[model samples]
Target: MLFAGIKTDIAVDMEPQLIPLIDSLPSTVPFVGPEALERKRNRAFKARLGANESGFGPAPSVIAAIQSHAGEAWKYADPENFDLKHALAAHLGVAPTNIVVGEGVDTLLGLAVRQYVRESTPVVTSLGAYPTFNFHVAGFGGRLVTVPYGDDREDLEALLAAVKREQAPLVYLSNPDNPMGTWWAAAEIERFIDVLPKDTMLILDEAYGETAPADALPRIDVSRPNVLRMRTFSKAYGLAGMRCGYAVGAEKQILAFDKIRNHFGMNKLTQIAALAALKDQDYLKAVIARIIAGRERMVQIAAKNDLAAIPSATNFVTIDCGRDGSYALAVLNALIDRDVFVRKPMAPGLDRCIRVSVGLDEELDYFEQQLPQALAAVK
Candidate 1:
């Protein structure tokens, strides 16, 4: 009746066709959030130690700023993100021209991918690196070439080799890398950059920079056109929900994002929150200390359970389950069944571990108590 004379099946058949690349891609996403799991289980997690988000909520000043600016939500944010850009410029010792603010690193990655990737253009990344980046590459019709992690860290030399062999226009690396939570020294990273081909653009994701050691990050160099350093307030600043992030690079390279970036994509509240967070360096340092203490506690728990935690420079620790992938998965499921929300890498070499994030004292206490039971259940 809705279609009148036309059959329902005929109407369905007349629906618009998807582009070839989109149609070819499998219907899947990069990560399944804890809320989705909660919905499926009909309950909430007792301990939320997954997704690497800071359980130590944002600075009090940041919250005050958000509350103060709540009324401004009725209006659109400044499309240029002018004030936030200049604030970030002052903080990072770079000019406003070197910065491009976006909804988050994830959105910026998509924009970067679109800028360089055409149909079947090669892209290089670590095999078990950030899946969101891989998702962006696939969506933009780029061929992904991956090198495996070496010694639990991104093999910079191997990544360079793949970039050269594939002549990839774009490459991605997360310092203090995710899932495994390992990092390389700044000097070594600088050496890698020196050898990289000039034509290849590097997306240096430093989302965990604040939680990492002082020497872990390379000094900001806006002179390099090929490197884009992506940072987010989500990790240490506790603003993942706000979704504010920015990338710093050479002037021309940063400006390139304007061609395809969603001008008004950033939420107004996020700008207010990030600006306040930047102004509170004292709070940032205090949170970083707590994260370090939490990391140490996580390591001790793993040891107590006869498991080993990979040394972490990020806010999360990836615990080696000392077994095969299936065994590790069982441990992860056992934790989930106990209302402990945690995650694990799914890639072959990295799947033998489960990742846990730093949380409040009580949450970690819950994790500590339940982890032994989870292991017992798995065994």
Candidate 2:
């Protein structure tokens, strides 16, 4: 319309420019949320047992901190993230310079990809690991070489072989991995590190670290230039909505985040929530115990159905439905239809299982009652 007078014989086009990488990208999310499904079903989920979010809730101290500081939302958060960095550093026995706080691990992952992934830059990861990380790589025009899981766990040896074979500049590993909910011991992780090529950067995602055994987490080592460890306030702290996470590595590697990170992207209240959550160690331990109990209950529910719940170091469990991907998917749809929100891994070998997040007692009860019904209906 603006060009009505100037266009004469030619038709007006209002197309905006987009980068080729983005232009070629598909508009897809890693996981469709329960809310979206609810919209389609026209009903609410009775059992919210997906997303691996803590149903135990954040520490009371964190809630209080958020309430006390809620009025200060007008101001921008400290771009340096000074208080949080210092708190995390002191807790982890590292220098503040070794920590880089971001909106969440997902954001930090994107930043990491931005720093390293150029067109066709080879990045290695388990085929069905964190899809968001893969999405970031794709967004940045990186070439992904995926290794399949071994025995329901990420094949660390295969990952190393691929990295060495391709001379990949970057690789991703999720300890206490998402979707699968399996983990490697710290000693095993150390051995994996030993074999890595010196120049390859490893993105070690430890989002479920709090729920994992202490022996599963290697001690904080900011000395490693080739590895960045990602942690979050989302899982045990029940602050996923707060969007706060941090990455730790050598000072230089941490500093690299500064070059491309959105300095003022952090919200003021999230800082308060995370700091308060960190201060309450007892609450975190209690939540961990609750998560363990919840995991047991879920396992019991699966067993009653003659299914096997995979041993999990993370907050959730992957239940083997004793069938192929199609059957597992049918069970998942059945659960969804029954107002029990759950998720499943869709990769070739991993698709025979359904993932269930730890939830409250009532929610678990709903799941318990509906799972058998779902199984029968699926059959």
In model 2, where is the ten-residue run with the lowest total lDDT? 5-14
Residue 185 lDDT in candidate 1: 95
The 10 consecutive residues of candidate 1 with the worst lDDT sum are 6-15
TM-score of each: 0.97, 0.97
lDDT of 2 by residue, 233-332 (tens): 9998899999999999999999999999999999999999999999999999998998999999989999999999999988898999999999999999
How big is the positional error of residue 222 in model 1, measured in Å on the Cα after superposition?
A: 0.6
User: Which digits, one per residue and each the tens of the lDDT, describe model 1 over residues 287-351?
Assistant: 99999999999999999999999999999999999998999999999999999999998888899
Error of 1 at 215 (Å): 0.5
Error of 2 at 182 (Å): 0.9
List per-prediction Cα lDDT, in the order shown: 0.95, 0.94
